[model samples]
Target: MILETSVVPRDSAEPCADRLVLGEHVLGVADGATKKPWDTGPDGAELAEAVAGHLAATAAGCPAREAVDGATALVRGLLGDAGVGSAVSFCVLHLGRREIWRVGEGRVLLDGLPVPPRPSGERIVAEARALVLRRHLADDVPEATLRADDPGRAAVQELLRALVGLRNRPDPRYGYGALDGQDVPDLFVEVVPVPGGVREVVITTDGYPEPAPTLAEAERLLAQRLARDPLMLDPPETKGKRPAANSFDDRAYLRVAL
Candidate 1:
């Protein structure tokens, strides 16, 4: 049974780049990567919606690898290589198997214990960006400046560019995976067991670094964090909330009680 669900865009004026699917014997949340306004590619929202649809139609007994492959092939067929770096991260719960399949970066908790994310240089990368944010804050930059026009992004432009290039690459160390119309290495796909006696499962996008079991607590924590660090640089590794935005990134949540 589902206890709660939410899919909200960071900027209400724009389309949400995240998706939630409550499917037969399957539940999922897909967080789409946001692109620069000038970038030319399929919109993240469109890709996420397509993925959600694919997963919903997928048979419950399908293997994890097969599901990922089919999704990848679907995207590749539609967009070809042009959308190589445009990607979406997903977390799915298969009730039939009592398992969870995840790809790319997001947050998931079974009974409040985190399922470790696939390894990457995420920590160091976030630290680098956070350092830039600190420098800007020291200069007395306004919150609006940080939100509307993040000048610090230029400082980490090279790193961000490299991250995009590494998407769906095969290299185990520095490479990562996403539903980006590229071949995803097995190392990047994860299968987590939903063991017995797990009373609750909470899944969310990276927008919420910490996943709370209930929607109320989660919202309270989010509000507290936004007040404390609107730029999302305190702990690092997140895109900052835009001016007039509720959160730094698109957020989706799904909670189930077994």
Candidate 2:
């Protein structure tokens, strides 16, 4: 199930935030931008869509980590083709009937405890930047380039650092940088299998808490509503509270049971 609402001011190319839920798994993607000029391009949103499409199709059969890896690859491919640069954040959940993995920063509500926040700073900036740069060289990488070690992943890390220095400058056509200066967030998550019972899995973007104090508060608020009215999971009131469109920030959240 996929539920999304775009806060208008649609004169720009950017869409609010978008989300996708497949089976017992959920995914959210948010695009961040700097306030300087306002280049609301389609790059971040497009990469997120690709991530959703790949995850929705392959997650059911593949390991959650593998699913995330493939989806990340897909995003890299899309951004490279467009010669676009932007930040990305994602969440992946499996029913816990099986193993699951989550990487990158975002909110994760397991049982009830909110995991301690992941490191979010220049590290995120380096990671998101590298993920985009890797796409350009993926095809040329030798299958044996790093048999014992994945050079591709390593290369991405290094390149990300180099790209971060190339700060956003004013362009008559493109505007300010999509990712101002704050680093993107990332998470690496996996749910340990419980014997057998119904379970609720929630994943959300950082935007949901931009105004709130912390992710724990947002998750608790959303979870309380879900416990009482599962249908309230997707409500128009939710959209109204989301960041205004053209802010170049997008967010998504999902809930699932197994």
Candidate 3:
């Protein structure tokens, strides 16, 4: 098998929260959720690394569900009593079977089209952010300037918190699934057979747009989009917190060809 991988951090100074592990017979990718200010324990990067390492170590022998459950338990134990939760979008590929185990927000492309387990959280956050922005549009604040320190941004964050809280309830319209140091009921695992001798798989974090054909193409398209609409304010894509820079999310892309 041939593997091509790429990872980019949102902030140059901070570590990337996405992790990739290629083992003897298993491949794993994990994207940690951004840490909140009030949260405690290790940061997103640390959590993602831990999860990826666990998956790589266990994927060769254990069932995908077991590996994910074990990793979640380990991380939860590490985070003891802090209300701050460490969440991640995780994927494990068993090379021999051409099977995939996916939990949360990452993408898996068999050939070019996305497989099961599409994302569900960011849209809720984006809608809340748009509502906040629309209410405060009269202030004429540039999206780039909407920092956490700013009052407007703070309000948006508050709304986001509320929205997230509501969504996390027992039975909500949208369930934003993640490896959130908790038991996840919506885990996705499937066997994917290659069609007509096609044997390529692309797995990625949500940072890359879905339409791009290849990782390099995704990067190029992202760069062009950021140049045109840095904040996604002119033509919004789901609507979320305004980014400080053009690319404000940690990104990871892994392609495996057999």
Best by lDDT: 1
lDDT of each residue in 143-190, candidate 1, tens digit only: 778778876665777777777777777777777788888877898888
lDDT of each: 0.81, 0.41, 0.64
Structure candidate 2, residue pairs in collision: 33-178, 102-188, 102-189, 103-187, 103-188, 104-186, 104-187, 105-185, 105-186, 105-187
Query: Which portions of model 2 show Cα errors greater than 4 Å?
Result: 1-14, 23-42, 81-84, 96-100, 122-198, 210-249
What is candidate 3's lDDT per residue for 178-238, written digit by digit as tens? 5556565533333345454657878887776552547788789778766775544444433
**TM per candidate:** 0.94, 0.48, 0.82
C-alpha lDDT of candidate 2 relative to the true structure: 0.41
Clashes of 3: 1
Candidate that beats the other on TM-score, 1 or 2, i.e. the better one: 1
RMSD of each: 1.7, 16.9, 3.4
Q: Once all C-alphas are superposed, what RMSD does model 3 give against the true structure?
A: 3.4
Clashing pairs in 3: 126-239
What's the distance in Å from true for residue 145, model 2?
53
| Candidates 1 and 2, the one with greater lDDT | 1
Task: TM-score winner between 1 and 3, please give it.
Answer: 1
User: How far in Å is the alpha carbon of 183 misplaced in model 2?
Assistant: 18
Error of 2 at 9 (Å): 10
Clashes of each: 0, 10, 1
lDDT (Cα, 0-100) at 55 in candidate 3:
75
